[model samples]
Target: MRHTFAELFAPAIVLVFSSGCTVGPKYQRASVPTPANWETPQPWRPSDPKDTVPKGEWWKAFHEDQLEALEAKALDANQTLKAAVARYAQARALTSQAISALHPQMNVAPLAQRQRLSGNRPTSGVPITLRPVTQNSFTLPFTVSYEVDLFGGRRRNIEASEASLQAGAADLENVRLVITAEMASDYFTLRQLDSELAILDRTVATLDKGLQLVTARHEGGIASGLDVAQEETLLRTTQTQATLLHQQRDQFEHAIAVLAGQPVPGFHVTTQELSGEPPALDAGLPSDLLERRPDVAEAERQMAAANAQIGVARSAYFPSLNLFGNGGWLSGDVTKLLNVSSAVWAVGATAAEAIFTGGARRAQVKFAQAGYDAAVANYHETALNAFREVEDDLTGLSILNDAKTTQQQAVAAARRAVDIASDRYTGGLVSYLDVVSAQQTLLSNEQQLAAIQGERLVTSVLLIKALGGGWDASSLATARIKPTIKQALQP
Candidate 1:
């Protein structure tokens, strides 16, 4: 019997549609214990899901143009963030690798060689000739192979790879969030130090003047030598503290330069006291956490990948089909290698099924299922932790807001005490020691107030981070694929 090439392949082509249904169980999104609203009992509103333009740049809400600029530069230049993007692109490439399996793989080889036949070689105890025969050998061969994907194993693999690619995308966004948050926190801490330094500067100046006054009084016999010694000690101690502050500020400056991808040695941020009240932020609904949090989205995508892997594993139980074809021409004369009489061709298929294995196939299916369960557990844990962070940041901001006001009043009262003590010391009603104690108290209160103010700003930044910095999962959903190198390189 003879058959046409198309006729021979008709059954395999039909198997692609008929028996090629994906072998693994369909994936369902993992269930999550979503809350209707935030647990914190404060004035908060849900994020608008319809707001197409979510806070792509949430840092701008603080209204600091300098901060916004720094964030922009970090996004463009930060090495660590760039590494995350490269990893995402790598996953995209792997997805393409998996898809290539669906199509036939082809190869061609051309050869030319000279060979000498042993004419006197024994065959059936007969010698053809006593003389050697030399001949030219020329050959051309072509081959094709295809895995039929009859049980959908290749399709399942592609599904798994695609899910992993989306996970990479989410990871990219998560990295961006982490970097931006770090930059903001570092920037704020540096500004906080600036405010503290300003307070220290003023205290140092006051102590210096007080020391001069005491030294003059002692020289004229109006004040004790002990008063002069004590005043000098306080002034010198403040000077030492301010010197330490300068060191701390330099470290933070170096950190900022690294984050901005700049050389650290000459980098400097001008000393400016921290200003601007913490912005009022809305704590969106707990359900919004799924859409907004990139970590959450990443965990969920992992679950999908795991689910598809189960199908790929189960497909091992089915028979594997492979189509193979090889054709070649061979001739003693190179010029005639392409002649019809010198041509040879062949085509066929193989369907292989393991009749017995040491339970390896079963073990693989179990392994895949375990992976899926682990992914589900991770997803739940991630959501729970996200909720905890939001509540903690909200409580911190609330308590710190109250502390700032009380601290302001304490600083005011301390200043009044210092003024009264100075007057009394000059009028001989109190010793210079009493004035020194008042000055120390006032300085401490002022520093405490500055710290409280800085704490408020820090807490606000944390809250913004906990809220996912205005991210939305829909952006990942609509992406068909990062097909172009240009798209893959972009964050």
Candidate 2:
């Protein structure tokens, strides 16, 4: 009249899996305020995806082969990115471990032993019938144990782990974007330094010529020795600036080398002037940033993970249901261990409820709730910061563009002043001090222009990174568990 173990567990398994019932509060994404559009002096116009949005090889937009190559090298060899990849792999492995709890566990253990029975042992109601004896026994046992997930506790754990894995993936992508942007920024900065050094070299040459003229005029009593001294001072000062520019270029080149995963002593970028403008960027709807930026995606994923953990904690309030079984052969003789008559088998179920822990379960639920609230706050904060970055870049680009134009005019006026001062000094109409002042102005204006151009490029890179470097949440949809570096790097 008693049911077999399979019959007893069959209904429980069916009900647990098919009921579609889960404990704890269901998840709903926490909302935060967002602006409808970006505020800018120049209204943004929609552009074709090919022109605005970064696609594959975002660095290609810079139109620099060296920069593109550096980006590729960094993506492949950067140590920080590799570390992020490792963390993502670790998260994936943990997710798999959590998923394992949903399935039954099976293990095999074969045991053999010798036992001794004592005649002195107490019996029910009789005198001793035999002396001490020894016996040999053998067993080949297999066992299976499974939690029914009657309240979906294990399912919630799996959910949390999966969300964590996704967050880790987002982190990896964010690191990649940041490294690539850094490499590009350094590359452009080196180029700008080259431009500045070239300007200084030319300025120094011009000053040398003026110094020679002043020295000749002073020897003929047509100019004062003070004029010669002034010209020499200007030439030497310009030479010193050239030396400093060389030092800065060296530092920037070394940074590029490190980013490209090479020894600084051996790596170098060829001298090139900063030319060409950064590609145009479009600021999409503020709402779209939530899905585009990897940091925001990561934060949102953390929130989901925290929400699932809350469910996991709430499920602790219910008893756990587990079914276990073991079947094997046992006999006094090893040769008879496999015989049907020597077979032994058993099956059973267990349910454990936390009857007392003084309020531990409630505290855990509160802890999980607090974590969820923190995650939500973090998510909103990240989104707001992202918006701020985009706006900052937008305003910077507009202002820098205007400054570049003004700087160009200043450089031209300074050049004209230098020419006029030299002509007038040679004609004995003005003192040599005017020429020195003009030359210094020209050099300073040129350096400022070069710096502004470099900053514009760096800001462009920053904007691209803020826009997620062509990454999106869809990239994590497959949720594949990539364990090896080779697997992770695969396209």
| Model 1 lDDT per residue over 115-203, tens place | 89786666786644567778898889988888788778888888899888889998999999988988888888888899989999999
Q: Candidate 2 residues 289-337, lDDT tens each?
A: 8889999999999999999999999999998877899999999999989
Candidate 2 displacement at residue 246 in angstroms: 2.0
- Give TM per candidate: 0.89, 0.94
Clash pairs for candidate 2: none
User: Model 1 clash pairs?
Assistant: none
Per-prediction backbone clash count:
0, 0
The models' CA-based lDDT, in order, is 0.84, 0.85
lDDT score of model 1?
0.84
Q: Candidate 2, overall lDDT?
A: 0.85
